[model samples]
Target: MADNYKQYTSCCQAKDWVSLSAYLGFAAAGLAVVWIPIIALAGWCALFYLLVAAAAAGVAACRWWLEVRLVCLGGDRSAIGMLVSSEPPADKSWPGSVDSDFSMNLLPYPALPGIKQADLELTSPYGFLVAEQAGTKQHVGFFTGEKATEKNGVESAILHAEFEGAGVRDVLIAVTVALGLAIAALIACVAIPPPWGLIVAGILALLAFLAALFGTLFGSGDHGAPGDVKGAPTEVHDNDPVTGLGADLLYVYGTWVFDSLHTGWNEIHPIKKCTFVGKWEGAWPADIVDVQHRLDAGFADARDPATVSRQAEDRFTWAIHPLVDGCGEAVDVPAPAQADAGLH
Candidate 1:
C-alpha cells in the first residue's frame, strides 16, 4: 500500500510538471510575440519574470487542486456528505434507484473559498459529477454513493464522489479554452492590415479549426472508467454474514466498521438502510470465512481484542491493513496457529 501510494503520488507530480511546463511555454511564447518586437532586452527580462511567476502560481494551483481531490475522494469518507450540506438546496427529488438520473450542488472545502457551489448532474450509476461552478458544466468527479445522514443536526443524503480522471479532463478543457482564445486574439492582431490581413486571418482560421479538432481528440480520453487503476478501490459491497455472525460488514477493500456495526442485517431503519450505499463491484462472496480469517489475523497482531470491539463504537473505521482488493478479493494472509497462540 505504501509503495502503491508513493507511485501514485509520483505519477501525479509528473503530470503536474508536464501541465505546468506546457502552460508556461505557451504563455512565454505569447508574451514574447507581443513584447519582444517593441522592447527587446527589457521584454526578455519581463518574459523571464512572467515565466517564473506564472510557473510558480500555476504549479501551486495544480498541486492544491490535486490535494483537494485526494482529500475529497480518498482521505475523508464523509467529505462528499459535508460538501452537499455546504451548498444551497435545489428542488429535485433523489433518484429512486442508482440507475436513475439526479442533480445536486457540490461544494468545495471551506478553505477553497474561490470555489463556488457546483451544480452536478448524475447521468448513470457511474458517471462524472458535472459542475457548472465556473460558468461551464464540466466533469468534476465520479459519483460513488449517496445515503441519508446527519451533519451538524441537518438531515441529508451524503454523496460520495471521486475526482481522478475528472481532474485531468478539467485541465484539458481549460487548456483548450485558453488556446482557442489565444488563437482568436492572434487572428485579431493579424487583421490590422488589408489583403495581407485577409490571407493571415484565413490561415489563422484554419490553424484555429485544426487546434480545436486536436483539442477535442486529446481531451476525449477515457474519463468514465472508475476501477481501471489498481490500489484505488472503486467498488463497495455489503458482506452480510450467512452464518451466526450477528453484525453486518460493509466491505470495500476492508470491512468498514461503522457506528451501526451492531445493527442486525434484517433491521429496517433509516440509519441501517443509509449506513451503506453504492453498488457492489461483483457478487457478494459465498462465504467470508477467508475474510474472517484475515480479520482474526489482524486482530491477533494488534494484541487487543477490545480495539476491534471499540471500532464498532466509532463513527468511521477502516482496517490497519485492507484485506481486499479493488475486485473484492481477499489479499491478506490468514495468521498461522503459532502466531495466534501467544496473542490468544
Candidate 2:
C-alpha cells in the first residue's frame, strides 16, 4: 500500500472504515506504549517525534494488517480463454501469505489484441494441489475474476499479488522508529530529574529502544510494520473443485473485487475450486451456447446442455456453472427484456 494506504483500500471503494480503524489502532497503541518516556525524555518537545512515529506505525499496520496479508476484493466478471501451458507453482516473488500459488498464462476470450489468456493465479488456501491437479493445465474454462474485470489498461495479464507497502515501507518504519527511540533514550540520560526517575526512564527507554532494534530484525507482525513480511505455509488439494475454475461467473454468491490498490491484476486470490472443463483447442465459437440460459426466459441453471464442446463449458462439479460461447450453431438466445412477460 502507498503511504496514503490507497493501495489497500482501492478495491474497497468508499467502504474503507476497516483500513481507517486499523491505522488509528496502531497509532494509538504505539503512542500509549511509550508515552511515559515520550514526556520524561524530552518534556513536551518529544511529542512531535512521537506523533510522527505513531503515524508511521499506523500506515504500516493499515497496509500489512499486522502481517496478516489479508486480501480485500472488488467486482466480478467472466472471461473465457485458453490456458496455454500447465502446472505452474508459486514463484520466488510470492508473499508469505500465498501458499501453493498456482498460476498459468491465459489468453482471455473476447481476446484482446496483445493480451494472452491472462494469468489465472490460483492459491491453495484450502486443500487443492492445483500445481498438480487443477485441470488448470491447458484448458479453456470459463474463468470468473472474483474482483476484477477489465483486462487492464496496462494490458498486463499477471495476477496482481504484491503490496507496495511491504517493500520500502519496512525500511521507512525501521529507520523512523529506531531514530525516534534512540533520540528519546539519549535525552532520558540527560533529562528526567536523575536518580530513581532517570533509572525508570532509562530502563523503559532501553526496553523500547531494544524493541525498535529487534523489531526490524524479527519482522512485521503487528500490522506488517518495520520489517519484511512472511507467513505460514498452507497446502492445496481437491476438497472443493469449484473456485479454481473461477467463482462469480454465473452466480456471484460472495463479495469479490479487483483489489487494484495493491496489485492491479485480476485474481481469484484464494481459489475456491477448479475443474478441468476441456482442453483449449483454438478460438471458441462466438456463439457457442448459453446452456444456463436460452431455456425459459433466461437466468436459470441447466444440466449437461452441451450438444457441442463449446456448450460443454458450463460443466461444474458443483451446481455453480460457467459462461459459454455460441459455437457451431445459432444461439437459442432468449429475449431477457421481455422476461417480465413470464416464461413462454
Candidate 3:
C-alpha cells in the first residue's frame, strides 16, 4: 500500500497555485527595475518613490498566495477514520466538465489530543463506496445544519481543499494581469498629479484587491498535467446518508497539502480510495472497527500517529492519539529518495 501510495504521490505531485498577487509582484519588480533608474535620472524622484511604493504594496499583499504546500504528505498511505462527510462527484464551479472530483473527509480513530468531533481531513476518490449510498436520505453530507442529524457541521472543515478552479495556465494569466496592474499603477503614478497619483494607486490597489479576492475565493485551484479533474471539491449525500452523526470509514490511499489558496492548513486533498466501515461505535475506536473484523485487520499493522504530529499542528491531530490497540510509532511515509530528498 505504501509503495503504491508513493507512486501515486509522485505522479500527482503537489499542484501549484499562483495567486494574482504573486504574478503582480513579479511584474511590479520587473517594471521597477527597468524604469526606476530612468525616472530618477529625469528628476522625477517623486514618481520613482511612488512607483517603488506601489511595487512594494503589490508584493506585500501576496503573502498568502501560492496555495500548494512544500511537503505533500500521505504518499502510498492508508488511514482509518470516521466518514464525517462525503462530497459526491459533480460538475461544480466549472461548467461542461466531467465532474470535478468525488471527495470526502475522514475523522481518524483514537482522536488526537485537543481534537474535536468535527475535525475532518479531506479526501477525493471516484467510483462508489457503498451500494447503499444510493438510498440514503443524505443528498448532501453532514455540513448542512438542518439535515445533519448529528449537528457535526457546527464545526468541520468541509469543502475545504480539492483540486478544482483555475488551472495552471489560468493562474499564469492571473499572474500576468497582476503584474500588468502593478505596472499600470506605477505608470499612472508617473503621469497623474500629487493627490491624484495616490488616488490612482489606490484605485489600482482596489482593482487588484478585487481580482485577488475573486481569485482567492474562486480562482485558487488546481491542475495536474492533462487529463486531470478541475474545479472545487463537491460534497454529496444520499441513501439516507450519515447525517447529524456520520459513519466510520477506513480511508485508504491519499496525499496531504498545505497551501494559501485554500485554508492554508495541511490536509488530504486527493484521496485515492475510501471504504465504508459501518457506523460510529464504541468508547475506543477499536470498538468501531471491530464491528468488521476484516476492516480491523487492515489497520492491524500500524497507525497514522507516526507522522500525524509532524505533518499538521492542529489539523491532522486525530491521527496522533494512541489507538485502542496501543498504536505503535510506525512511520506512515518512508524517507524520500536522495535526488528528490527535499521536494516536499
Candidate 4:
C-alpha cells in the first residue's frame, strides 16, 4: 500500500486537491473560482503557476481516493465464536451429536512482527478474527475415541482456521489499468495542445504511475510477504489435549493464501482464495471433552461438512463430536499441550 500510493503524497503536499478539484469542477461549472481569476489576472506569466496549481489539485484528489481504510468488521461473538466454533449449531450438543467445533489456530493479528493482537480488530469482510503470528502454521486433527495421531505422535482434536482472501487480486487488474492510464496521460501531456493541458495531463500521469507501481508490488495476499522467507505450510497448529482422553474423528490440515491488490482510497477491492493441503486424516483418535462445553446448541447445521463446502462460506460454525467408544484411560498430564515431545 505504501509503495503503491507514494507518489500521491508528493502531489498532495505540493497543493490541496480537494480545494483545487472543487475549484476546478466549480470553475468548469462556472463558480467564482479564485485560481482561474488569479491565473487570468497574471496573464501569460502565470501559466506556469496555473499548471503547478492544477497538478496540486490532481494530487489531492488522488490522495483522497487512495486513502481507503480497512473496512470495519463486527460481531461481538466473532472473536469468541471464531475461537470456539467453526460451524453454527442447531442446539447445544446432546448425547447424540455435537453443537460446535473448535478452532485453535486463530492468530489475532497479521504475520508482521511487533504487531499486537489487541490492535487487530475483526471485521465482516475479513471473514474471521484470527492472528497472523509470524512463523506459525495452522494444523487440524480428528477425534478418534482413543488417540489422535499426527506424523509425530498421538494428540487431541483441534482444527486450525486461516483466512485466505476476499478476492483482492482484482486490485492487480486495477493497478494495470492505472498504469495504462498514466502512460496515456504521459503521452497526451507531451502531445497536448497547451501548457495548462500538459500540466494537468502530467499530474494525472504521475498519480496513475504511482497507483500501478505500488498496487502490484505490495498487493500480494501472502501473509509472510515483504519479510523472512519460510517454505513450510502456512497453517498453525492447534495444541493436542491430555493423553488417553481419545475419540474418533477426521482432521483436515491445510493452508490458505490470499492474493490481494489495492487500487484507490475508496474503491471496493476483491480477494482471491488459494488453499494448500498439508495433512489429512480420515479416522484418527482424539478428545473434545473439555472443549465440548462451549458448543452452542444446534450449531451443526451451519458447520455440516456438506453445508460448509456447498455455500463456499469462509466463516461458519462446526461441531466437535466426541465418539464415546474411542475413549481410553485419561492421562493426568497438562490439559492443552502443543505438539509432541520432539517437534521443533
What Cα-based lDDT does every candidate model obtain? Answer: 0.30, 0.35, 0.40, 0.30
Residue-level lDDT tens digits of model 3 in 119-176: 3222222111211121121321112211111233333332222333233334334445
lDDT of 4 by residue, 60-79 (tens): 33333333212211211221
The TM-score, computed over Cα atoms with residue i paired to residue i, of candidate 3 is: 0.37
Candidate 1, residue 5: Cα displacement in angstroms equals 7.7
Which stretches of model 3 miss by more than 4 angstroms? 1-35, 41-64, 67-76, 85-105, 110-172, 181-244, 248-252, 257-266, 270-344
How do the residues 47-135 of candidate 1 rate in per-residue lDDT, one tens digit apiece? 23333333333344444333322211112112111123211111222221111111121221211112211222232211232221221
Per lDDT, the best of the predicted structures is 3
RMSD of each: 18.8, 19.3, 18.9, 23.6
lDDT of 4: 0.30
For every model shown, the clashing-pair count is: 0, 33, 27, 58
Query: Model 2, 218-313: lDDT tens per residue?
Result: 333223111121221122121113222321111101123333223223443332222232333334444422421232122123222442344444
Weakest ten-residue segment in model 4 by summed lDDT: 1-10
- Name the runs in model 2 displaced over 4 angstroms: 1-11, 15-106, 110-113, 116-255, 260-267, 270-344
- In model 3, which range of ten residues has the least summed lDDT? 140-149
Alpha carbon lDDT at 179, candidate 1: 47
Q: Which stretches in model 4 have alpha-carbon errors above 4 Å?
A: 1-162, 166-170, 173-177, 183-187, 194-198, 216-235, 238-283, 286-300, 303-344
> How close is every model to the real structure, measured as TM-score?
0.28, 0.33, 0.37, 0.24
Task: Please give the ranking of all candidate structures by TM-score, highest first, separated by commas.
Answer: 3, 2, 1, 4
Alpha-carbon shift of residue 316 in model 3 (angstroms): 41
